[model samples]
Target: MKGIVLENKILNDKYGIICIKSDEFAQNAAPGQFLMIRPQPYDYIYDPLLRRPLGICDINEKKGTFSLLYMIVGKGTKLLSKIKKKTELSFSEPLGTGFNLTTDKKVAIIGGGVGIAPMTFLSKILHENNEVDVFYGGAEEKDILLTHIFEEYSNNLIIATEDGSIGHKGFITEVFENSLKFNNYDKIFACGPKPMLKAVYDIIDIEKIEFEVSLEERMACGIGACLGCIISTIGTDPNSNSQKRCCVEGPVFNGKEIIWETVCKE
Candidate 1:
């Protein structure tokens, strides 16, 4: 883990929605990747273990800074929320394989909930050569954050919220499917809940549109040192099943290669 101090904190709400800017490991990070962080001066009374994994929200290479947007969901995150500017934090960064960008191709990007973090970086990368269309879904209006950043790279931006507080009163997949009908996209890139990804896979399975998905699993060690994040895959030797460690093999995988039935059922 690398120790770095926060430069700024931009709170999105009282629910512990925070965007932290730090000069930890910005230049080395890639889109759809993350950092495993542990708050410095560890509080054994409050936070026992190291910090949890946070996706790299955005990076400013020129300034050598990176950002992380997180909602305080648990004890660790709650402590993280209380941290002020200039407070030091430890980070294990540039972890996980990111999205694969195809040259000269138009792609549809889909994100749900906090999964939108990495998509912002992915959009920045894809904007260089490929046209990007983004579809984002959240529980409500407040849940949907970082719209302005995505708009910078997206040729078309669509939003969906369950409460109808914002854009369409439905799921992101609905918007994604609608976009598919009118656009000729070469591929689809997505990161979100497993159910949403399964739904997307079902649609593309029949339509035969090339797609890639980033999976989120509980990880013990950010690196492959621990086998805690193993996921099964259908590889050669069909009679014998194989496993791929999400920490190393992929947080990103080809949509078709994933054993969706087993993954979804689990």
Candidate 2:
């Protein structure tokens, strides 16, 4: 799908949010789904031939707009930040399986840093039927992305910062553990840095809370043809469901499907 950048505004100088007016992509976008975006104009040759895959942060159906919130971690994102309004870019969109939004049970979404992108989209939809809680953690105060958005959609909004500059003065895992004392959650959805995701998985597993995690992997081909973004699954036997594709089959997977030993906990 093709889109024209309507706004590209920097937030906290560390990252930026690019809102685009796209009739095709936005109309078909779903919560927690992503798009493979090439920030360069259609005529330009982007240094990296592969488009960067970004999660859909906001979907405004009424306005026919969608936005991507990205952190400037590498060259791909750096280029994305330079893109200006009215820039026409191409995308392969609405890819991968989004979160399953059902159930009247209690649900919690714990995310860190840029991982908060998809959680906001999920929170907005899940809160409509379930009791939802959103726990967002960042490096500092300014890193706490969008609190007002979460507040409007979730039943409880909690935040954590490494620098003690925000709601809770520790990792989001700490906040999650404390939250368990007061709330009995039936399910959890987490997306974040590997360590935080692992920690959340461990705790929720012990509590026997049904949960799913969204994995982040580097993909050269967003269509899963390159097999570049493979994640380990429990069934390790050959021809088994041992290797999962982050681009096609997921981004979201059952908690038990992940092979914890294969992931670096620390």
The C-alpha TM-scores of every prediction are 0.91, 0.94
Model 2 per-residue lDDT at 255: 72
Residue 115 lDDT (model 2) = 91
C-alpha local distance difference test of each model: 0.77, 0.86
What RMSD, rounded to one decimal, does every model reach? 2.3, 2.0
* Best candidate according to TM-score: 2
lDDT of 1 at 170: 91
* Prediction 2 TM-score vs. true: 0.94
lDDT of 1 by residue, 1-266 (tens): 45454443545652333334444567677787877877444545444475577777788777677777776677777777777766656677679887777778888899998878778888888888998889999888977887888788888889999899999999989878777778877899998888999888877643557888888887878798888877778888888657888877778888887888788777
Number of clashes found in candidate 1: 0
